[model samples]
Target chain A: DAGITQSPRHKVTETGTPVTLRCHQTENHRYMYWYRQDPGHGLRLIHYSYGVKDTDKGEVSDGYSVSRSKTEDFLLTLESATSSQTSVYFCAIRGDSFQETQYFGPGTRLLVL
Target chain B: AQTVTQSQPEMSVQEAETVTLSCTYDTSENNYYLFWYKQPPSRQMILVIRQEAYKQQNATENRFSVNFQKAAKSFSLKISDSQLGDTAMYFCAFGQVAGGGAQKLVFGQGTRLTINP
Candidate 1:
């Protein structure tokens, strides 16, 4: 199994507060992605990084930002938490090879009130 | 733009039985990749199977197999001898061919599968 860990497995914050979720991978994968899962909707991509300092927005990039300063670490931050942002977030890593399957982290559940 | 569709919102199967999950996608690109991911109650997403549009033969992984029909834009997953561990939310995803450095996965709504013991 790929070594991937998500810090703060569960969090509860008030609206308008700042929240940060961290994803650390022991496998030096070139591709890292952040996604949110909600009921009735599948996992929606929020942000992804191809390499250190190289990041891009995904389908649901609003209200979220990401950074990757090192190959093993990827961080997702919510500038200001909102009730709508409450959901389960997952981090995935994949190799540079085409058609490679992604390995996912356990996931972080966030609740905003 | 590419989109994945899973018509069945929920399904149930008896243990030791065979069950098939449906997935259909819309894409203009001739070459791409399709994947099935299983998210168990633990919320860990695991890859079940994958199919490349360029490949004519379907892809199978142990108890999981996929029926890939490129012309019809359909890719469905079949699970043989289902077990209680198979209960989870299944998502069908589509990804573009690897040319660009960044490839984002587009996912379907997801189908909840319950395996009865």
Candidate 2:
């Protein structure tokens, strides 16, 4: 898990409501990413942030948004959650040194009813 | 765009045996990275090994090694002297440096590996 921790590890929410997942890191890595894992799909990127206040979309960014206000916190929000959006979300961070590789958090399991 | 494929969905082997998991990727970019991730029942994504495209030498991590064929665009993981703790779902991933130098990863469907006693 490195220094990463995801809040609300398990969440049960209703469709059409809003949901936000938090990823906090203590090492202050320069890069952070959000991904979702599902059966037969392994894991797909949802969004990533290169630095504080700098963010971009990923392969499966639809229906989801991200915010990186501080270097330590990255948030992923489902403005209008749908049943199809139910999956386990993971957060990862890249070390500042030579393509060191990304370390992941424990992950958050979100179920939309 | 890059895509990673792990052809084997599941594999079973006895402890101390050797096994290989196949992974093929499609990508036009020459500068990239290849990785193998292991996820056990605990669901923790652990980094197994990685290979850089620019490097000609294959990557090895103790009991784990990779057979990377750059021309064929294939990267396979081989495990020797397997142990029961090695049983897990293994994912192959392709990585590229995105805008602002962020490395983005695309993963395969995953291969469930079981090491029997």
RMSD of each: 1.3, 0.8
lDDT of 1 at A112: 100
Per-residue lDDT of B6-64 in model 1, one digit per residue for the tens? 99999999999999999999999987889999988888898898888889999999999
lDDT of 2 by residue, B1-117 (tens): 788999999999999999999999999999999999999999989999999999999999999999999999999999999999999999999998897889999999999999999
Cα RMSD of predicted structure 2: 0.8
Model 2, runs deviating above 4 Å: none
Task: Evaluate residue A75 in candidate 1 and report its C-alpha lDDT on the 0 to 100 scale.
Answer: 99
Q: What is the interface RMSD of each candidate, in Å?
A: 1.9, 1.0
Query: Which pairs of residues collide in model 1?
Result: none
lDDT of model 1 at position B8: 98
**lDDT, residue B41, model 2:** 97
What is the TM-score of each predicted model, taking all chains together? 0.96, 0.99
Give the Å shift of residue B108 in candidate 2. Answer: 0.5
> Candidate 1: where is the Cα deviation over 4 Å?
B97-100
lDDT of 2 at B112: 100
Clash count, candidate 1 = 0
